[model samples]
Target chain A: MRVLGVDPGLTRCGLGVIDAPAARTLTLIDVSVATSSADADAPDRLLAIADAIDAAILKHRPDAVAVERVFAQHNVRTVMGTGQVSGLVMVAARRAGLPVVLYTPSEVKAAVTGSGRADKAQVAYMVAKLLGLDEPPKPADAADALAIAITHALKGGGRTAASGASATPAQQRWVEAERAARRRN
Target chain B: MRVLGVDPGLTRCGLGVIDAPAARTLTLIDVSVATSSADADAPDRLLAIADAIDAAILKHRPDAVAVERVFAQHNVRTVMGTGQVSGLVMVAARRAGLPVVLYTPSEVKAAVTGSGRADKAQVAYMVAKLLGLDEPPKPADAADALAIAITHALKGGGRTAASGASATPAQQRWVEAERAARRRN
Candidate 1:
């Protein structure tokens, strides 16, 4: 299955596509970031990001979309922008008849680095190693996007075991870590 | 000028269109609410709201779009959904080549009624009186949507005096009241 991962943000949104042939096996297809000028009008900025995501969905035709779940507990100003962009991503995925799944940051980190509290550098390193890339994806957002896609792919597409009832040992650990992180927040 | 106002929400989104023939004179063109079930998926809910807003933009062909500005300081759970819907509305307006303006709840209240602190009932009463309707628009969301449209019309479309540099006496008062409300919050 092919998955498109979106690290949604108004200023710089990351888009990454990967082909998951089997469990714990992945191949990178495409990765890029969409950006808009802060000086532009709010509507124009959002439309620009929407156009980028639409173009990617048309180009890649991924089977499902995975987006970073935004929490209001984050930065007050940036969270709104993140939520807005996530909304656009979900709508675009649904319009294309693709399933949309959201993975928390800790879930992504745990899926890739074996630690829910892994720092960005560790997550990026694992993403590079897992995808067999020469180096980590440029910028943190791009790496995060790929991490989200990897999380969805390894978790059985996030549909069959959303409650972690039928998850593997590794997947169950990730779920437990996510719950702990939420409680800490 | 014809203005389409959007009171954005996840479960229920309000849309109102009005024609401003002259300053302080308005006619109600359309008013309705778009609803989605809470049991539905997140993507489905957002797409339903987006489709309704897109249809209204196509059907009404408004010159400008006005939406209630969402504040993150409000309800944590509801604010995210509000921001998401507002993003969709702004994107639709821009896609149709119409200018989009955002008015805070206080600004809408100040424009429709004399005080920024006016309650929902007062704002609805003023919206009905200004539109020459026998009764206020049904549902508080509908009235709030119309009130946003009326605010844009009364404020000269929100393009010329965005900084309040060239605002009229009434608009200047509204701007001051908005600042006071912000400070109080």
Candidate 2:
């Protein structure tokens, strides 16, 4: 199964693709996206984000999309930012006929690094190591995007043990694939 | 001008305080509210979030808070998560002494990154680089939180910017301290 992980933004939205095989190993495919404008009023900007999401869907052809869900942001303005990106991503996925799996920051952290309170550097480091990469992924956002995908791959009904630290080889392959894709991006 | 940004989450919430001094330099301070089953019931969770917001206000104190206005996500369950988080955060701000500054995601991206189509990472990177941070803040969620505060600093005036980035840091310190003293658990 192929999974696409996305980190949406206006200037640089990150996309990571991974092929999840049955052995728990992730087959890294590719990761890339544009950083446009994420302003609320710019319909053109929203279109760009939609286009980016569609492009990823068409290129990766992932069966599922693992997106980071936004909790309430203390600022209404910031939450609006979360909602706008989320809305565009959701629309693009729906249009592409892919299901979206939402993951909380903590859940993704725990799934990838065994700690919910893990920092971005830790999450990035774990993502690289999990995929057998020599260095942590750059553009930290992309690494996170990949982690979201890996976490879902581990949690999706295809898992062996269904919890932290027990992914099968196929699951492992999917995670590895995500890291490989990051470098290519 | 001082702007406060908040990323509200049921489990882990983020808070950021930024002083956009007129001297072309920025001072940024951020924090997080870590909760784990601390709220026994739905209401309790709401209150916990509210209290967290209050705590943020007391700690970072800003003339205005830029929050992302809440939107109903695709799934009802997800929408509930967004709404509850927003409600508590907003309530806390009102209960404190600050006026709320709301913006849509696109607006924030446009205001911060000069585009409405940017993703969270793009925004965060620009936010960090623009504010002079060597690296982007962790957990996209916290980055979003910082975005909210920066939004207020940039917009010029919604409620108080009319008073200036209300441009001094002393007022910010006072408001933050008051909120801290009145903190409720």
DockQ values of all predictions: 0.38, 0.02
* DockQ for candidate 1, C-alpha atoms: 0.38
Model 2 C-alpha lDDT per residue in residues A14-126, reported as the tens digit of each score: 78888777427876678676665433233334446656777888877888777776655334445544545654565456556555656778989999999999999999898
Specify the poorest-scoring 10-residue window by lDDT in model 2 chain A: A157-166
Residue-level lDDT of model 1, residues A44-155, one tens digit each, is: 7899999999999999999888999888878998888889999999889888988788888898999999999999999999989999999999888899899989988887
Q: What's the lDDT for all of these models?
A: 0.86, 0.65
Query: On a 0 to 100 scale, what is the lDDT of residue A179 in model 1?
Result: 70
**Tens-place lDDT digits, model 1, residues B23-110:** 5789999999999887777788899999999999999999888999888878997888889999999888878977788888898899
Deviation from native of the Cα of residue A139 in model 1, angstroms: 0.6
What lDDT score is found at residue A95 in candidate 1? 88
Segments of candidate 1 deviating more than 4 angstroms: A160-185, B160-185
